[model samples]
Target: MDVVLVSRTQAKLDATADEIRAQYPSRRVKCVRADFTDPDTSAVYSHVGRELHGLEVGVLVNNVGLSYPHPEYFLKAAEDRCGDADGGKAAASAGWGPQLFDDMVRCNITSMVNMCRLVMPGMADRKRGCVINIGSTASRIPCPLLTMYGATKKFVEKFSRELNTEYGGKGKHGTNITVQCVMPGYVATKMSKIARTSWLVPSPDTFVKSALQTTGLEPVTTGYFPHTLMVKAIELAESISESMMARTVMNNMLGIRARALRRLAKEQQQREEAQSATATDK
Candidate 1:
C-alpha cells in the first residue's frame, strides 16, 4: 500500500514524508510538493508517481488549505466588509472583498478538486483507490470571522459528500473512489505558533496521525480531544433549538476570532523581541 500526500509547503511535505517513512515502514510512501494553486501544477503528482519507480498511489490525502491568505471572498465574515444583503455581490462587483475570496476558492476548493480528478482516472481504471478530503470543523461550526475561509470549507464538505455518494454505489471507470472528509480543529503549524486558537489546537503530528487513522472513512474528528466532546455537547445542548445551532456556531466563531487575534499579538511580540536582539547585537 503506497501513500501520496498532496501539499504546498515544502517543510510540511518534508516532515510528513519523514513520519510516513518512519511509521509505515512496511508500506512504501512518497511525498510530493503539489501546489494546486496553479492549474498546471498537478503534473507534479504524476511526476512523483513516476519517480517512485514501482509505486502507484492507492491513497491520496488532500490536506491543502488557507484562511485569509487568498485574494477573494468566497464567504464573507463582515457584512460591512462586503456589500448588500444579497451576499455582497455588488461589493464584489465593485472590487470590495472579492479578490481574497477568489484566491481562497482556488486554493481551498479548486486545487483539491483537481487532485481528485487527477487520481480518479487511474483509480477508476483499477477499481481500487481511496481519497481523503481534509476539511475544518470550522465549517460545521459557523466561523463568522473567518469569512471566506469558512465558506470555501463548506463547499469542500458538500463537494466531498456529494462525490462520495455519487460514485459510491458504482465504481467509475471500474475504480470506485471513496471520498472522505476530515475536519480537524486548530493545528500547531508555523501559522498556529503565530495564532493560537483555543478551539482544540493539536500538534500537526497528532492531527495528521488521527487524520490518517480514518482516511478512507468520513470521520469528522475535532483537533482536540476535549473539543470533540464539546461538539457533541454543543449539539445536544442546542439539539432542540434549530436556531441554537446557528447561535452556537457564531459563539464559536467569536472565540476563534479572539484566539486568532491573540495569536497575532503573540507573533508581534516575538517579532519585536527579535528586532530588539538584532539592534543590541549591532
Candidate 2:
C-alpha cells in the first residue's frame, strides 16, 4: 500500500520517504510538512487535509507529540515570565514557563483529535480503517515530575478507547474502524535519547512491528512484551500501596531532573569559560 508521512521537517520526511522507496519500489510515498507545535490549530489541520485530498487513508497514526526537556513541577513549569521585562531573572530561576505547557497540549492532544476528525470520516464511508495512537507508560502510573506530559498521554488512552467504541462495527453500514492506543515504555529513539537497544528497550522499528501486530486484536496495549512487563510491575506496586508507587516514581524522576540540570549548568559554564579565554587572548 501507498503511504503519506506528515511531520515538521521536510528534510527528514524526504529522507524517510527515500528509505521507504528503497524497501518497496512499487509503492508510492508522499510527504507533508506540518508542525504540530503551531498554536493555530485550524490552519495546520486544514493544510494537512488539503495535502491528503483524494487519497483513501486506510491507516492513521497519531504519533506526533511533545514533552518537557526535563521533568519539572507544574508550578515551576507554569510560571509566567512575561511579568519579568528583562526575562533574565526568571530564566535564571526557572528553565520552563507557561508557553511550554501550551505547546505540550497543542502538540500532544490537539494534533491527535484534529487528525482523527480529518481522516476518520473517510474511513467510515469506506467501512474499514485502523488508527494507532502512541501513548506512554507515564500515563499508566502517577508521573510526578512529568505531570503534564503524562496527563496528555492519559488523554490519548481515554480518547482512543471511547472513539473506538463510537465507531467500531456498530452502525448500519458496519464501519470497522479500529482505534488502538499503544502505551509503550522506552524505545531506542532520539526522543527517549537512548542510542543502544536492549530486550527491555527495543528499537523503533521493532516496537512498531510489535504494535502493528496488535492493531485489531487489542484496543489498548504496551506494544512490546518487555514494556507490558514493566507496566504490570508498576500496577503490582500500585496494588500494594498507591502512595508508595507514586513516591517511588517521583523519587526516580527527581534524580533524572537533577542530572539533566547539572548537565545544562556544566555546558553553560564551559561556554562562559571559552568566551572569557577568547576575550583575554584578543
**Each candidate's lDDT (Cα)?**
0.63, 0.86
Candidate 2 has which clashing residue pairs, if any? none
| lDDT of candidate model 2 versus the reference | 0.86
- Candidates' TM-scores? 0.65, 0.92
For all candidates, the clash counts are 14, 0
| Maximum-TM-score candidate | 2
Q: Which ranges of candidate 2 are over 4 A from the true structure?
A: 80-95, 170-173
Alpha carbon lDDT of residue 23, candidate 1?
84
Distance from true location, Cα of 95 in model 1, Å: 18
- lDDT by residue for model 2 over 1-282, one digit each (tens)? 999999999999999999999999999999999988888888999999999999999999988888876777777667654213322332333436778888899899999999999999999988899999999988897789788999999999999999888888757746899999999999998888789999999999999999888889899999999999988998998999999998888899988877766666666577789989999999
Best by lDDT: 2
